[model samples]
Target: MHRSVTAGAAAAALLALSACSSSGSSGSSGSSSPAASASASSAVTGTVTVFAAASLKNTFTQIGKMFEDAHPGTKVVFNFGGSDTLAASIVNGAPADVFASASLATMRTVTDKGDAAGTPTVFVGNGLEIAVQPGNPLHITELQGLANPSVKVVLCAKTVPCGAAAQTALAAGNVTVTPVSYEQDVTATLTEVGLGEADAGLVYQTDVKGAAGKVDGVNFPEAACAINKYPIVTLAHPSR
Candidate 1:
C-alpha cells in the first residue's frame, strides 16, 4: 500500500489520526524533537470532522479511536461515503477538517475548487476484487464471468472511485458487463453481495477483506490496470 502524509497539512492530518508513527520513528531523533512533540500533543484539542471514502471505514475508525484515546479532549468524527460524493460535499461548503478520498481524481475535485488546504497526500493504493457469496455458488472466477446475463452483478456508479476503477478494469479485460445495479460506493456494492442481494459485486480488496467471513474475494489480473491511489488533504474551512 502507498501511504504518505503531507508535512504542510500535518496538524490537520494529525487531528484526523495520531496513532500511526512515521517510518523514522524508530530512530533516536525523529522528525520532531521530544519538546516539540509534547507541545504539539498538548495543543491538539476539540473535534476534527473528516470526510472519508467508505472503503476506509474499517481502518479509519480504528485509527480515529486510537487518536481520541491519545488526546483526551480531541474527537475525530468521520463521514464515510463515495469519494466523489464526499468531494462534492467539501466543494459545496461542508464543514470538514480533513478529506480522505479513495481516488486521486475525486480529491482533485475538491482541490480544484480550492476546498483543500496545503497539498493532498497520497495515502494508499487499492485494487479491485469480485465479492461473491461465502460458498461461491455461482462459481465465478474472473471479471468476464460477470458478463453472464444470469449473474446478478452489482457495480459502483461511474462517478465513484470503485466504479470508475471497475470500468477501467473491464475495458482493459475487454469484457462487456451490464450490472444489475450501480451502487454509490464500494461498501454498498460489497453489501449487496454479502447480503445475497446480488450474485457478485465489483469492489475494493479492502472492502472484501473487511467483510471476509460474509463474502469471498476473487482477484483478477486486470485489477492491476485499475489500481486507485487514495489521497487525503486538510480542508480549508473546518467548523468545530
Candidate 2:
C-alpha cells in the first residue's frame, strides 16, 4: 500500500508535535512543568486529520487518543487505509493535515507533488509474516509452504507496500504463490485468513499482532529481506 523511510530518530517527537503547527523551525523543550503543559495545550485547538496506512490502525489509534487527552478541546481524526491509496487521495486533495505512510515510495507520491510540510521521516519499521488460522492445521511452515497448490493464499495488490514486500520476500526465498485473491490492503489480506476465507496471507507483523486470536503468525527467514520503514509527515494543506 505504501513505499520508503530513512533514519528513525527524525520522527521521535513528531507524533505529538506534527499536528500542532505549520512552522518548520525547531525548538528545544524545557522541563515538563504545568505552565509548559498549559502552553502546549493552548497552541492548537482544532481537529487534525491524519491519513495513515492500515497497518498503523492499532498503533495510531492509541496515539490519537493520547493526543486528544493531552490537548483538551483538540481532536485528532485518522483515515487508515493502504498507503498507496492514501497517498493518491492526498495528492488528489483529500484534506488531511498529517500523513503517516508505511512505505517511502508511497510518501513520495505526495511529497513529489509538493504536498508535504517538510521532509517525511522514518518513524518505525515493519516486517512481513505469514498469517494463518489459529493452529497449523495444514502444517504450513515457511515461504516455501505457500507454494503448495492447495494452500489457498491471499495477497495484497502489488501496488501496495505490504504486497510489494511479500513479493520481495517470496523472491528472496525463490518461492512462487498463486493467490486466491489480491486484496487492496494488508488489513483486507489478513482478514481473509482470519475469517478462514483463505489458508494464509502475507501481512505485516504488526497486523498479526493487532488481529491476535483471530490469526496466528508464522515467522520466516525471508521476511528480513523485505522490512518496510514507516514515515510520518505533516501535509502541506490549508489546515496548517
Candidate 3:
C-alpha cells in the first residue's frame, strides 16, 4: 500500500513538470513572433535623389548634410547642373525627388509638363558678379570692361539662368561683350575664370562665395537690376 501511494505521487509530480516546460516554451515563442514582425516592418532605408542648379551645389550640399543628420536612416543624393538641363531631364523621366532651379523660366519647363508636385517656393536670391582670377590680373573694373577687345570673356549659354540674367544686365547697361566661350552652365563659366582660362566670367555671387580665395568677385551696378531668384519644387511622381 505504501509503494502504490509513493508511485502515484511520483507520476503527478512528473505531469506538473511537463506542463510547466510546455507553458514556458509557448510563452517564449509568442514573444519572439512579435519581435520578428517588428523587424520586418521597420526595414525601410534608401536614398532621395535631388537635381539642383549648379550654383546651388555648395549651399544644397550643406543642407543635404543637415537633412541626413535629421533623418538617420536615409541618404541624400544630388545631381547638380544647369537648371534648364535638369528641368529637361525631369521631363524626360529622370528619377528625382526634388528639383531646384536658379530661375523661374527653368521651373516653368518642369511645371508645364505637370512634373512638379505643387507651386514651387522661392528659397533664395542670387545676383551676377564678374569673377576674375585672384588679384584681378586683367584689371577688369566694370561691366563695360568686358567689352574691351583684349579681354577674354566667358559667358553662360543664353538658355541657362546665369546667361539670361547676364543678358538682361548687359541690355540694361547697353554694353556688348563678345565672349570667347559660352558655357552651358554657370559653374563652367566660373571654372574658366578660376583656371585663368578667361580674363573674366559672369557668374552668380554665390559661386564667387564658394571660390573664396580662388577668385575675386566684382559687383557691378547691373547685377541689382537682374537678380535671379532660386525656386525649389518636389516632383508629383518622384521615383524612389
Candidate 4:
C-alpha cells in the first residue's frame, strides 16, 4: 500500500484549529482561570481521512487511535485497500487527505496527476513470503516449492505491488508458478490461504505475521530481490 501524512504540517494544524472552533467547546468550566480557558480553546480537533494500503491496517489503526487520543476531539478515518486501486480512486477525484501506498510505482500515479501536496516519502519497506496453512502440511519450503504442480497457489495480480514483488522474487529464484487464482490485492491472496482455499500463497511477510494462526510464513532467500518500498504523500485536497 502507499505512505503519506494526511496533509502538510501547516494544513493539518489549520484543520485541527478549524475543527476545534466549529465544535464550540470551552475546555474548562466557568469557574476555570482565563489562562486555562485559553489553553483549552486552542486544543486541536478535526477528522483526517486517510487512504492506506491493506497491509497497514493493523499498525495504522493503532497509530490513528494514538493520534485521536493525543488530539482529544480529532478523528482519523482510514480507507485501506490495494495501493494501485487507492491511487486510481484519488486521481479520479476521490476525497482523501493522505495516501500511503505499498510501492513507489502506485504512488507515482497520484504524483503524476499532480494530486500530491508535496514530495512523496518512503516510510517503510516489506518483503514477500510464502503463506501456507497453519502447519507444514504441504511441506512447502521456498520459491521453488511454489512451482510444484499440486501446490494450488494463489498469487496477487501482476498489476498489484505484492504480485509484482512476487514475480521479481520468482525470477531471482528462477522458479515458475501457475496460480489457480490471481487476486487483486495481497490481503485477498492471503485470505485464500488463510481460509484453506489454497495450499499456498505469495504475500508480504508482514501479512503472514498479521494472520498469526491463520497461516504460517515461510521465508526464502530470494525475497531479498523483491523488497517493496512503501511511499506516502498528502493528497492535494481540502482538509476535512
Candidate 5:
C-alpha cells in the first residue's frame, strides 16, 4: 500500500520560506526569528506525513504520538509498508515529508532520484529471528529446524529487506527451507506465525517485539550476520 502526504499547501509555504531565506541577507533579523518561529509553529498546528517500513509501525507510531502531544494541535500521519514499495511511491511523486526505510537499498531509491532533502541517517539496527506461536509448540530451535517438512514456514519476499536478511542467514547456515508463503513485508510474515497459519517465520527482532504476546521469538547465531540497518531521510520538497 502507498500513502501520500496531504499537506501540500503547508509544504509550499515552507519551501517558499526556505527559498527566500537562501537568497536574502544572512544577517537580516526578519528572515531569522520569524522564519524559525514559523517553521516551528508549522509543526504545532499542521500535519507531518511520514512513510516508514512495516517493521517500524509500532515504534514510530508511538513516537509520532509523543511528537503530536509535544506540538499540541499538530498531527502526525504515517504510512507503513514494505521499504521497496514505499521508495517506489516516493520516487513516483508521493507527497511524503519523511521516509524511513528498513534497508539502505530502498532508501537509495529516493536519494538516487534526488528526492531527499539531506543526507540520510541511520536510525536503528535490527537482526533476524524466528517467530513461532507461544509455547514452542513446533519444537523449532535453529534455522535448520525450518527445513523440517512438517514445519510450515513463511518468509518475506526477496524484494523486502527482511526477506533478503533471512536469505543471507539461511545461506550462512547452508540450509534451504521452503516457505508456504512469501509475504510482502516482515510484519506480514510475523502475522502469519502469530495467527498459527504457519509453524514459523523469519522476521526482524523489532517485529517480534511489536507482536508482544502473539508470538515467541527464537534467536539463532546466524542472525548476527543478517543484521539490518534502518535509514531515514527528509524529502527535498516535502508536502509538510
Candidate 6:
C-alpha cells in the first residue's frame, strides 16, 4: 500500500488473473497490468486462496471484500503471515491460489521452486520506520537512537522482510541495536510498541500509520536504503 490507488481499479489490476483454459497451462502469468485488466473483465468464478505478507493484512482484507462484492460467487480467502513463512508453506505444497510477498527474496523462494504459474509482479513498495509510544516518549528521532541501551526496542525476526530491512537501515546509519524481543511478524512487533511493553519497534510505515493514536512513527534518512518492494504471483496448483 505504499502507492495508493483507486480501490476497485487497483484491486482488479492486482488480482488480475489470466483466464484458465481447458488446458491448465493456458493461463498467463500476469506480467503486465493490461493483461490483468483483460483477464479481469472475464467472468471469474470459484474460490481463490491468497497467501500474503503480514504487512498487507488491512489493505488486502479490504480488497478481498471488494472483490467478493464485485463477483458474488467468487470467494477470496486469505492466509496472512510473515512473507518468508508463507513462501515456505507454498514451496512445501500448501494449496494457495495467490502468493503476495513483502520482499523479492521471499517471492524468489516460490518462483525458484516452480510453484508460481508465471513471473511475480511488483505491486507496491514500503519503507521502514521506528514505532514509539505516543507523546514522543524516549524521543527517538533516528536509527542510532534505537541503539541506546535504555530504548527497550523490538524488531521482527531476521527471517522476515521487515527485520531484513531494519538491519539494512541500521547498517546504513552505522548503528547497532539489540532489541528486547524479536517478533515473528510486523503486527507482533507493532503490538509491543502499542501496548507500551517496549519503548520502540522497527516496523513498516503502513503499520505505524494503522496504529493511529496507539503509537507514533519516526522517519529517519537511513530508511531510504531499506525500502521494500512487494511482489505477487499466481500459484501453479490451486486447490479450488
Best by TM-score: 6
Best of the two (2, 5) by lDDT: 2
What lDDT does candidate 3 reach at residue 218?
Answer: 89
Which portions of model 3 miss their true places by more than 4 Å?
Answer: 1-45
Taken over the whole model, the C-alpha lDDT of each candidate is 0.77, 0.77, 0.74, 0.76, 0.76, 0.77
Question: In candidate 4, where is summed lDDT lowest over 10 consecutive residues?
Answer: 21-30
Q: Comparing candidate 4 with candidate 6, which one achieves the higher TM-score?
A: 6
Model 2: per-residue lDDT, tens digit, 139-175? Answer: 8888899999999999999999999999999999999
Compared with the true structure, what per-residue lDDT tens digits does model 6 show for residues 159-180?
8999999999999999998989
The C-alpha RMSD of each candidate to the native structure, in angstroms, is 6.2, 8.1, 21.8, 10.2, 9.3, 8.2
* TM-score on alpha carbons, each prediction: 0.86, 0.84, 0.80, 0.83, 0.82, 0.87
In candidate 3, residue 38 scores what lDDT?
A: 44
Best-first order by TM-score = 6, 1, 2, 4, 5, 3
- Name the better of 2 and 6 by TM-score: 6
* Global Cα lDDT for candidate 6: 0.77
Query: Backbone clash tally for model 6?
Result: 0
List, residue by residue over 6-119, the lDDT tens digit for candidate 5. Answer: 344234323332333223211112233565456544533566778888987876677677666756655667889999999999999988777888888889999999998777
Question: Model 4 over residues 44-160: C-alpha lDDT tens digits?
Answer: 556677888887776677667766776665677888988899999999989877788888899999999999887775656788889999986989887899999988999999998
Backbone collisions counted per model:
0, 12, 0, 11, 0, 0
Alpha-carbon shift of residue 127 in model 1 (angstroms): 0.5
True-vs-predicted CA distance for residue 161, candidate 4, Å: 0.4
